[model samples]
Target: MPAFAIAAEDPATPDIAALIGQHLAEMHACSPACKVHAMPAARLAQTDVTFYAARVDGALAAVGALKALDATAGEIKSMRAADEWRGTGAGPAILAHILREARARGYRWVGLETGRHPVFGPAQRLYAAHGFRECAPFAGYVSDDFSLCMGLPLA
Candidate 1:
């Protein structure tokens, strides 16, 4: 297994920005234009969002972000594992980090909007393994055939 570490990161950094570009491209490829909710690097840098990066053996491997919806809820966004690290635990590491941050902030629950296509199967399974369940959309998201909304309650 690859050794990995996840930490808060500046989304606008060149390497991070490049990865986000790839993430956005993939989201667009699999979902309709209006249903692609992945945020751009500039948006991830906003104060309400906390972006994270995972590095495996000292090389960037994945990225994820948490956006505060309110004091009681947070939204997970922009999760992506580099092609080379997709099954190397990099995605899980960043996801765990984001959840820890949510708990530390006293959030009651966390949720996310993901695509409903076969290409998103792995991501859906990842969320499920971490205890997320399908739920009504949150934080201004609308119910749609192309979107899968999931949530996990924090104690």
Candidate 2:
């Protein structure tokens, strides 16, 4: 297994964009009917947010984002780990990094939306294991049977 490094970068960076594209492709390929909608790479690259990518031996292994919602709030978005690296702790490490970054940026709360499908079970567990608790939807999202919302308070 390759060692991984997680860090932030501009979404527009060529390598970052490619990594995001690859991550999105892997997610879609794994779950074509994914309850959580996959944002197009172009749209993701245009967002004003902190994006982190996991690199193994200088190759992208995963990518995720922390979007600032307000002075004390942030939202997790587009988290994806390469299929080859899924069971190698890449996901959790990337998530932990995002949480740390959120706290560092003065965010009092961080939340995420994910599918409630079986394929998402691991992700839900990952979040729960990291101290995130199930919560009502935020950021204009309405209740949906196929979706789950989770949050963690930093304070």
In model 1, pairs of residues that clash are none
State the displacement of the C-alpha of residue 153, model 2, in Å, after optimal TM-score superposition.
0.6
Q: What is the TM-score of each candidate against the true structure?
A: 0.97, 0.83
Model 1 whole-model lDDT (C-alpha atoms): 0.92
Provide the global lDDT of candidate 2 against the true structure: 0.79
Candidate number with greatest lDDT:
1
After superposing candidate 1, which stretches have Cα over 4 Å from the reference?
none
Candidate 2, 50-126: lDDT as tens digits: 77888888776778888889989999888888777788888888898998899898999999988765777888999
For candidate 2, the 10 contiguous residues with the lowest summed lDDT are 30-39
Flag clash pairs in model 2: none
